[model samples]
Structure formats: C-alpha cells, structure tokens
Target: MSNSDPVLLIETVRPDDGRTESFWVALVITGVLLLGGLGILLRQEQTSATDTRPQLDLLQRQFLMELTIAADEIRFITTMNSEVSTDTGFVNWPLEQLLQEQLLPVFPGQSAKAWQQLEPGCLLLPQPASRIHFGLVLQQAGSSIHYAPADVPLPDHCETLLSWQRMDIQS
Candidate 1:
C-alpha cells in the first residue's frame, strides 16, 4: 500500500439500526409531550389565579360598602335617639321617625324600641327622668352577621364607624 492511497484512508458510513432509531425518536417525542403537558398545566393555573384576583377585589369592595351603610344607619339611629332623649326627657317622636324611615330600609327585619323609667317623685313635685334606653332587635337571615351596637360605635361625635371583620367562604 502506498502512503497516499485513497482506499487506505477511506471511511465507510453505516445505516442506523431500526430499533435504535425508533428508541431515539420515541424518547424525543415523549420528552416534547411531557414538556407541553407541563406548560399547559402551568398556564391553566396562572389563568385561574388571574381570574380569582378581580373577583376577590369585588367581594372586598362589596363588603366594605355594606359595612359603611350599616355604620351610617347605626349612627343615625343613635344620634336621633340621644337628641330626643335629651330634649323631651323621652324618646317618642324621633324614635318613631327613625324606625319608620331609616332603620326599616337599612335593617329590614330589625326593630328599634326605647324605654323611659321615670324617677320617684314626691306628692307635689315631679322627678326628672335622667336616663333613656334604646334597644335594637335584629333578625339576621343570610350568611352575614348583624352589626351589633358594640360592633358599631361613634368616633368622637362622628357619624360613621369604620371596622373590619374577616370572613371565609368555601369555593
């Protein structure tokens, strides 16, 4: 053989085996399918998360609005009762008006009652009634809890009360 002979340096190319080629193709296809499935799962989770955020925001806003209205109703009732108690030594007209107008609309199944216990008087003199009592009877029917008198309080003569209560709902 000569040093420069082309036949001495020639390299033959062999065909791939069917089993090996099929194994490699299956592996690549399985890997691609797994990656695609994972990608779809991740995208679905992200979309669900994105959709839930706005719904949560809307629920929070609704709760806040309801709380505000409840606070306003409480304030109006208390202030009207206090005023009438101080003026007439009994809460009669204001209590009736408040119950008929404001309280009925806001708290549908609730009723407001005022009581006056007069002081003991001598034979010729009348004792001044010093205290007035206002009570609210509420019948709550839905999932929401009624705002109690303790739950709603005036803020330094302010007409509104701001408070937060956490609620959980199963989806």
Candidate 2:
C-alpha cells in the first residue's frame, strides 16, 4: 500500500429516508415513557405514606402503653423505697440511674438525653416527628402517665392540659 500507488476509494452514502422521523418519534416515546415511570413512582410513594399512617398510629399506641407500664413500675418502686421522700415524689430516688437501668432498656433507640426530668415527680419524654414543628410529649407524673401533642414548648414545671390523656395507674 505505497502512497504513490493508485488507491481505490469506496464512498458509502446514507439516504435521507423516513428514518429521521423515526428518530424523533422514538425520542418522544422515550420521554413519554420516562414521565409515566416517574408518575407511577410518585403515586407509589404517596400510597406508601398513607399506608404507614395506620402503622404509625398503632406504634404510638403501643409505645404509650409501654410508657404507662414503666411509669407504674417506677411509682411502685419509689413508694416502696425507704430513701425516697413521698412528700417530694421521686426526690430521694436515683431517678436518672433508675431510668437508665430500666426505662431506657425497654426503649432501645431512645437516647438518655431525650429523657428530661421536668421536676422531681415529673418527666418529659418527647416523641419526635419527621416534619412537625410540634412534638407529642409523654409525661410521667407520680403514679400516672400523660401524653399530649404540645404545640408550645414544655415549661420547666410540668403542667397537664385538659386535652391531654392521662393513664391513671392504681399503684
């Protein structure tokens, strides 16, 4: 294949047939398919959220029940303990240590920081939500467990609202 030698060149030509129209049609079809797929995914996501609502409600109910039981147990313990002063409720009992050893174990993922003692006899455990500015608070006061969706920040002193549901345990 010397440069000087006569080279036989073959040129291939593409005809401007209806294939160009097919390309645009395919492009439009692809776009429509992609949009449809995305719409389906969005619908499924909405459905999933609605589906989980009932489950979430059920879970909250269960959690509240467990918290009630825990509160009752703590109340009984404090009542029985000689060190604890009944005048000041949980004043003399090792409340933090007690919660760490007992309550925190039942709630696996809850951090110790999440549990706050509003007072000697009162405790506030906030139930966090994904997008809500307000949170539901589980309050344990003496022998009863109370819960409410608190729109306002919890005060230093525990105050029960009339709207709040209190589970009065006969300890």
Candidate 3:
C-alpha cells in the first residue's frame, strides 16, 4: 500500500435509537410536573391565608364567652348578697373591678381599657386579638358578640350596635 493512498476503511452509520426524542419527552414531562407542583403550592398558600378569618372569628367568640361567663358569675354573686343594696347603676360591674377581684381571667396582650356600659342594660368590651377587632356585648336577656372594623369606632350607644355584624356564638 502507498503511504499517501486514500484509505478505504468502511464506516458504518448507526441507526437512530430515538434517544433524542426520549430526552425531549422526559424534559417536557419534568417541566410540566415542576409547574404543576408550583401551582399546587401557591393554591395551598392562598387557602391557608384565607383560612385565618374563620380562625380569628373563633378566637373572638372564645374571648366573648370568657367575658360573658365572668360577668354572669359576678352578677350572680352580687345578687346572692342580700345585705348589699341592689343599685341599678352598679348592676353592670366594671371590667377593672372584675379583674381586681380575680373574677375575670386576663388573656395575653389584653388592653387596659375599661368596658363600656352603653346603656342601663347594655355593656360592651373590646377584644385584644391583633388580627381582628371585635366587641363583646352583654344585655339583660342574652349576650351577643360583634365584629367591628378597624376604621370604624366602637358603638358608643346601643342604637349603633345594630350597625355591627353579630357573630354566631355556640352555647
């Protein structure tokens, strides 16, 4: 064989095994799965955020119940004491007096503000929960809990109490 002669070595071309197509399919599937996972995560976060309102509503109800039970207990005690004069003005016991007497339980981050007596039989107290503003209303018959907006002031009179939405309290 001559040194510079053109080599005639046979070259075989391998048939296509569809590796490139398989890689593309895998890539597309992985991308879709990643995007789906991201969408699911976002939806869950949104749901969790919205879930807070009901939880806050529950908290407000609990606080109102606590205040109502304490007030009722104090009223019962006051009524049992026959020697003490049953003054109409003294019927709605002040929150300070209740706390001072250890009749009312102090919750975390509670405001030092006193409970307001809207009228002779109506008493309202503000809730201290940070997320939502609420008021607990005590009347002669049954007590009601109310949700107050942060921008609007609390009801100064029983007439204004109608403007607030009454929350459902179970028992």
lDDT of 2 by residue, 1-171 (tens): 788999889999889798989999999999999999999888873444343222236656677677666766665665565445546444354457756666532334656567666655556666565211111223224455555543545545655422345544443
- How accurate locally, in lDDT, is each candidate? 0.34, 0.54, 0.59
Candidate that scores best on TM-score: 2
Compared to the true structure, candidate 3 yields what TM-score?
0.43
Q: Per-residue lDDT tens digits of candidate 1, residues 1-171?
A: 887877747789788668888999999999999999999888873434343222224533454355445435544554555533343333233334544564323222223332111211000001112111112221111112122123233222101111212222211
Clashing pairs in 2: none
Candidate 2, which ten residues in sequence have the lowest lDDT sum? Answer: 130-139
Q: On residues 11-71, what C-alpha lDDT tens digit does candidate 3 reach at each position?
A: 9987799998999999999999999999988887344434323435565567657766765
Model 1 regions lying over 4 Å from their true place: 1-17, 45-171
Top candidate (lDDT): 3
Model 2 regions lying over 4 Å from their true place: 1-56, 104-108, 130-142, 160-164, 169-171
The better-scoring model by TM-score among 2 and 3 is: 2
Worst window of 10 by summed lDDT in candidate 3: 82-91
Q: What TM-score would you give candidate 2 relative to the actual structure?
A: 0.49
Per-model tally of clashing residue pairs: 0, 0, 0
Which candidate do you rate higher for lDDT, 1 or 3?
3
Estimated TM-score for each candidate: 0.25, 0.49, 0.43
